[model samples]
Target: MGREFSHIARRCERAVVTAYRELRDGGRGDLQAFGACTTLYRIHHPEASMTEARRLVAEWIDHHVVRGASSPTDGCDCA
Candidate 1:
């Protein structure tokens, strides 16, 4: 059961990474994509907690806003 939960968490993490990459690549940064992934977990595994989802979203926002890491094509080179 732990392994299954870990696998789910890993998949969620990957979704975050992919979304970030898309945003960095000059693509849309809407919350829908992020929400879709989280929603999937919620719908598929009702027993799973959303602690990880919340953490990922918070981290994603922090990375894009507070950290000033603009999209890759945003003309800023300051990682």
Candidate 2:
């Protein structure tokens, strides 16, 4: 999975994906990793609502991890 994240264009997306994969690989459960990722997003985007944070995190995880997709992702204006 080393090269899986190299192509991400957004800082926020890259951070979230790297952190989520690391957390999961380190024995964290799905919910735990998801919560940590949500918090990570909030740290970069404090103005984001909890709803928005969770939505984006889940979308990113599903897109990059679960779906193994390399396509562009949508989120905050952090690109």
Best by lDDT: 2
Clashes of each: 0, 0
- Report model 2's TM-score to 2 decimal places: 0.93
Report the lDDT tens digits of candidate 1 across residue range 1-79: 0111122224444354455445645655556655654565455445556875555455644554446444322211122
State TM-scores per candidate.
0.34, 0.93
* Predicted candidate 2 versus true structure: per-residue lDDT over 1-79, tens digit per residue: 3347778888888999999999999999999999999999999899999999999999999999998888888767877
Worst 10 residues of 2 by lDDT: 1-10
Candidate 2 positional error at 68, Å: 0.4
CA displacement after TM-score superposition, residue 12 of candidate 2 (Å): 1.1
Q: After superposition, how far is residue 69 of candidate 1 from its true place, in Å?
A: 9.2
How close to the true structure is residue 60 of candidate 2, measured as C-alpha lDDT? Answer: 92
Q: Identify the leading candidate in terms of TM-score.
A: 2
Task: Candidate 1: give the clashing pairs.
Answer: none
Where does candidate 1 stray beyond 4 Å?
Answer: 1-9, 23-29, 40-46, 50-52, 60-79
